[model samples]
Target: EKEKKEKKERKEITPEEIMKPYGVSVDNIDDDEVRVLTKENLYDTLLSLAAPVRQLRLDNSEKEDRESGRRVVIGMVGYPNVGKSSTINVLYGSKKVAVAATPGKTKHFQTLFIGEDIFLCDCPGLVFPSFISTKADMICNGLLPIDQMRDHRPPISLVCQRVSRESLEHVYNIAIPKPAPHLPPDTIPSPDDLLNSYARARGHMSVQGRPDESRAARIILKDFVNGKILSVVPPPILMNGLDAHGLQKLTKDFNLIGTKPAPIEDQDKEKKRKNRLLNQQRGQRQYTDEDEMDRMVRLDSVGHHQGGKRGGKNFVQNKNSNKPWLEMKRAQKAQKRAKKKR
Candidate 1:
């Protein structure tokens, strides 16, 4: 009877009771207030969040401070390499602070004035204690630098488990051997197979003429961080109509509608215009045979008047008629000179 009562109590524990230990009240939560942010729509997301963020700050601020016209200071805080500095840089419309792929780049907290009465404070990234299944998860998620990792197997194994062997082969453009027939059909390829294949393809060989697994691991991790390998976790719930409408507005504003190529008509028109202008310029510069003959006569007269002989092999009578032959002779002479020099 005691065990049954305890089990019943455990099963009856409400969300509010579960969150009480974390100082959160389920009744105060507003599901409609949630905003989904993604890298694809970062600027739009930030713009939408700006008003709410400022209002929240003002609401929480003391009345005296609000009356004093104190600047709204927004603190940017998150795990390492999660784009805290990058966000500030984007908001500031310039590189306000240094940003890098490696974690822990921001060593100190820095403040930047973004607008008339707004300031953004960037804090150094620090990992908070949480219930993590494994250290490999942190490394794969880019919380830790892959280069500094002493053991690459665990993280690479995690990556293999998450990303399929086919995806690995396609992304790296290297063939990965299939698991042995004795293994289960759904078995994933080992980290060694991926590392070895990548290393050989990229010519990453160690001092002992073995595949350089460490170098390959770092390269793979960097690719993962840069999103070369697609890994996206979708939201638990689908977007509501209001959220969908907002997304549609954003898409229209950003011109993110169709992937079809731009109309070739415009390009064709531009190309025709360019060709017409080029033809006009060419016609203006083009010299007729009569013009060329007259110019050559003038040059010959000038040469004779200057007391220079004109019957040498370099000179030709009616040069315009024998222009191709003259050019061939010049080219042959150039080839002879090149051979002698060599």
Candidate 2:
């Protein structure tokens, strides 16, 4: 009865209540509602959002100044490295604004005219203060740059806790040492073990011939940020059989159409096949006029010239198809026969 009551209580707790301790307000979260949009469809989504502004401009077109009324200004502001410049570049269909993985790349406000009447204002990214539980959490969330991090162990430890040792090994192609038998079976591998193994595998050694953990840590953190580790936090409200937006379907499709290249064995087989064909062509004898005449004489000797057929089947000529050389040879043979009769 106690277990059942605890399960009921846990089920009754809302996502907002769960996040309240983390200083995150779910109700105050207001960003783009559309989670996914392809580049081809971005224009349509932007047009839908701009419909109201376009209508307002049309309604006040007569009273407002001609220049001001025709133009539409949209300002983009968000946290650092949250794709503000990338979004503008996508809308413009070219790389107008500079974008980088590190934050604070856009240091000042800039204006760009994407369309005839639409002006996009890109403001510098701002970092807002929040009640963070630990510095590791901030680093894991990519709020701190990995290259500038003084201590990388804490954030790497957080990653080790979230991602399994097998997954890390597969990604980095290095084996991490397992914990001692005296420790609990559930104990995860330490950041030191992963960093040491990864550093050794990548040949990142220090001056003293020790594994360079700092360099390995930067590489691992970059992979984590770029989604190579494949970590994601699903929304609390998400439920099975209730994906109205078909995001789950799209994800499955993307997985089916993987971006990875073919296996090494397959690539090697293709190269070998190409080389074999090239060698075979090089080894074979080349075609010449003498070879063509010898082939025609051999065919006539074999009684293949009767009715322009070979073994009672229509003879197909070479790729040139004109057969003018064969006709000239036949004329010279007829002239030699007439001179012998004279």
lDDT winner among the candidates?
2
Write down the lDDT that model 1 would get.
0.65
Q: 2-75, model 2: which lDDT tens digit per residue?
A: 66765555434354664454455778765677467887687676666776887788787776565677677778
Please give, for residues 210-239, the per-residue lDDT of candidate 1 as tens digits: 678999998998787777765533233323
Candidate 1's TM-score: 0.50
TM-score of 2: 0.53
Alpha-carbon lDDT, every model: 0.65, 0.68
Residue 275 error, candidate 1, Å? 56
